[model samples]
Target: MKKLILISGTMGAGKSTVSSELKNILPCNVFLDGDWCWDMQPFTVTEETKEMVHDNIAHILNNFIKCSEYENIIFCWVMHEQSIIDEVLSRLDTSGTSVKVFSLIVNEKALTDRLFEDVKKGIRTEDIIKRSIERIPLYQNLDTIKIDASNISAKEAAQLIKDKLK
Candidate 1:
């Protein structure tokens, strides 16, 4: 059986960074970022877009699960709610796949610092800080594993996930 690893967090919680590092550490692994499915220029957050994005993510994930070239699959997204997670998971064919989900949490200061750096790099706008922070609490109390990502590099976080999977 293959492994399916899903990493979820807020906008500045290093989900993409750690997901990339995990790909580097794992041999024969396929990595996918959920943002790639929702890369609309105007970026509207309607229910229709949400459903479409989830469908797209599920389709890609099912493909990855069926592919034999990859022993492990990694995906990163800002999944703040359990219902969203459930919906995505329900769409996957996991008959021979072991799925693991991790949620990254950071201190408020660390999150703000990361968001500021993202803004400086032109990857994120300043208003994203407020929006990201507002969803932090919603990420907790879920069924997924939670990791404190306050003072770790992406490589370190990936190593932690690799260790946990072992």
Candidate 2:
């Protein structure tokens, strides 16, 4: 059976970085970052755009799942809510897939430091720090494996996730 790995975390929690490393270590794998679906100018967050992004992600993931060339489908995004995860899963044909969900948990200080570094480098604006920090506790309530990423490197985090699969 193929594996469908869903990686979730607050912004700046290294979801993209870890997922990238995971794709490298996994055989016949494809990585999909949710942000890529929402890469629109003006970055709108209206209900319509949210729906469109979800549909687009589901479409891409479903196509990947149907492809026999890939044995592992790795997806990462800021999936802070159960409904979002459900919505995406509901749209996919995962009949023969073993699905695993993971949330990258980070300490407040560590998250703040990471976001601040991104801000300093102009990768992200300073306003994103508080918003990202506020979503930290939300992951605790999620029904998924939690990886403590406060002190670990992205490669280490990916290794931990890969170990969990075995």
Candidate 3:
């Protein structure tokens, strides 16, 4: 009876800020930060924590289904592989739950600029940024809407998503 709007994009792609603006216009929604799934301790993305990230997402999805107070959920995170994205979506699609995904993407230049901004904010590093550059969408279905975050303002992008969802 409710919708799950899953938001995915590279870091600094404005997913969080744009989602926030869209949130004011939405009803019965819950916003989740995918990065929060990462170990809160300061650590680089490496072999040690790879599975943990996926596991964390699965756990979060479970929590969302169990919450009795909310009618809709918007889960936001950095999504890289389409297979992985689809797998997550398939899992969440079970048990009468509806899942929709929106992907925010940009070019290498934007990635560099955003990653550098993260370096300043202390959420990323040169290595992490290097690995993510040129990463493509993980899912290719018609249900997914991919937006160019580099060429638009947050307000404009949010409107784009709202329009697309209509």
Predicted structure with the largest TM-score when compared to the true one: 2
Supply candidate 1's per-residue lDDT for 20. 95
lDDT of 2 by residue, 58-155 (tens): 99999999999999999999999999889899999999999999999999999999999999999999999999999999999999999999999999
lDDT of 3 by residue, 1-166 (tens): 6667778886667788778876766777778777777746776787667667767777777677667666667777776667767767655534666666888877778768877988888887678676667454332332567888887877887778767665
Report each candidate's C-alpha RMSD, comma-separated, in the order given: 0.9, 0.6, 3.2
Candidate that would win on lDDT? 2
Each candidate: what lDDT?
0.92, 0.96, 0.72
Residue-wise lDDT of candidate 1 within 16-75, one digit each (tens)?
999999999998999999999989999999999988999999999999999999999999
Off by over 4 Å in 3: 42-53, 66-68, 136-143
- By lDDT, the candidates rank as 2, 1, 3
Lowest lDDT 10-mer window, candidate 2? 82-91
Clashing pairs in 3: 81-138, 82-138, 82-139
Deviation in Å, model 1, residue 146 alpha carbon: 1.0
Better of 1 and 2 by TM-score: 2
lDDT of 2: 0.96
Clashes of each: 0, 0, 3
- Deviation (Å) of 62 in candidate 2: 0.5
